[model samples]
Target chain A: QQQVRQSSQSLTVWEGETAILNCSYENSAFDYFPWYQQFPGEGPALLIAIRSVSDKKEDGRFTIFFNKREKNLSLHIKDSQPGDSATYFCAASGNNAGAKLTFGGGTRLTVRP
Target chain B: NSKVIQTPRYLVKGQGQKAKMRCIPEKGHPVVFWYQQNKNNEFKFLINFQNQEVLQQIDMTEKRFSAECPSNSPCSLEIQSSEAGDSALYLCASSPSGYEQYFGPGTRLTVL
Candidate 1:
């Protein structure tokens, strides 16, 4: 079973618009959630993250809205730029799992200028 | 702008041949993790280490895959015998603590 799951396989939005990507997890033990952005041929880079305690986290134009009770989260890219086009992965980790991360399949995002 | 470094960005190995990849964690980071990403973008955790001691590893890694993070040396992951199923991008990440990890430009391994 997939512990982490991404709702969309892909998402498209116009430049300057907000693109939202959704994710969910099955394991209640997961307390830390992180979003990673990956360009072609490169490894995933940390974008934004939230702990179970916080309902939201923001970094520049990237925002993560987390609902711990629902076991779901969403990444909102405000003022989306063409340079933001890439695959986004949502990963989860818990105290019991140490540092091991369980990642979702990923959502490929495209921003049209 | 991650400082984690991985060598041999690409490797092509024949079946049954040995494949090795190396990773240098970020300076002052004591925790290192290895993961395999397949064509489908599925990530499989291979192993992890804190300093020179291993913390956890999957079953596959305990078998044909061998990994070591020696003190003052770059960590390495070696496949005893390559297989088509082993072809994937190997990613190395380092963490200051254990929550947020910084990833390197992975090494892509192709087995034929």
Candidate 2:
């Protein structure tokens, strides 16, 4: 079974719009959630992360709205730009999680001009 | 620039041949991790080390795969015998603390 899941395989949004990507996890023990953005032929980079203590975490145009009780989270990219296009992965880890990340299938985002 | 560095941006090996990749984690980051990303876009955790001691590894890492992070030396992951299915991008990451890791550019391995 997949421990973490992303609803969409691909997403598209026009420039200046808000693009929302959804994610959910099965393990309730997961406390730390992080989102990574990957470009073609490059490794994933940490975009933003949220601990279970916070319901929401925002950074500039990127925001992560987390629902610990519901085991779900969503990444919102405000003012989505063409440069924002990439494959986004949602990952989770918890106490004694062995520092091994459980990554979602990923959502490919495309921002149109 | 990226702090985590991986050597040999690409490697090609025939089936049953040995393949090796190396990585240099960011300074002061004692924790190192290796992951295999296949063409299907799946990330498979391989192995990790704390300082020079291996902390954890998956089944795939237990068999044909062997990894070591020697003190004062760059970490390496070697596949004893390459398989067609072994073709993928190998990524190395490091973190000063757990949960907040950074990744390298990755080494693309192609098995024939």
Candidate 3:
């Protein structure tokens, strides 16, 4: 079974707008949630991450709002710019799983100028 | 910092031929992982190594694919007999704690 599921396959937002990408996971033991960004012909890079103990994490223009009860999380990119266009992947892992990440299908975000 | 690096960024081979890809992990990282991404946008776990020791691997990887990481040498994944189904971007990644892995530019393999 796919443990992590991303809701949107693609999203587009205008410059300076906010783009929200949603992700839901099935494993209850998953405590580490991280978001990765990938550009064309490049590997995915860490954009932001949040631990289960915290409800939210903010870094620069990226924010992750996590809900433990619902097992859901969303990445919000505020003041989106054209350079933010890329594919975003949400991944989850548990403590005992040796930190093997289960990644979602990924959502392609296009920040239009 | 010259993070992870994969050689032969693009590879193409005929069916039944062998294909090989190499990866050099970031300095100071102990754990390395390989993942295969299909055109359908699904990422499949291949195998992983920790300082030359094979930690874990999926069934698909163990059957036809073989990987090795010699001391002080770049890690390599080789296919005995490539098939059309093996066409995909193979990504190599390394992490210090396996929590957040840093990925290298994937090696795109095309089996014609």
How close is every model to the real structure, measured as TM-score?
0.98, 0.98, 0.96
State the TM-score of candidate 3 restricted to chain B.
Answer: 0.96
Q: In model 2, where do residues sit more than 4 Å from their true spots?
A: none
TM-score winner between 1 and 3, please give it: 1
- Candidate 2 lDDT at B9 equals 92
Ten residues in a row with the worst lDDT in model 3 chain A? A93-102
Fill in the DockQ of model 2.
0.62
State the C-alpha RMSD over the true interface residues for candidate 1, after superposing those residues.
1.7
Clashing pairs in 1: none
lDDT of 3 by residue, B38-98 (tens): 8776888889888899988988777789999888999999988999999999999998887
Model 1's DockQ? Answer: 0.69
CAPRI classification of candidate 2: medium
Q: Which residue pairs does candidate 2 place in steric collision?
A: none
DockQ of each: 0.69, 0.62, 0.56
| Candidate 3: CAPRI quality band | medium
Model 2 C-alpha lDDT per residue in residues B30-66, reported as the tens digit of each score: 8999999999789999998999989999998999999
Per-model chain B TM-scores are: 0.99, 0.97, 0.96
Cα lDDT tens digits for candidate 2, A1-113: 99999999999999999999999999988989999999999999999999999999999999999998899999999999999999999999886534788899999999999
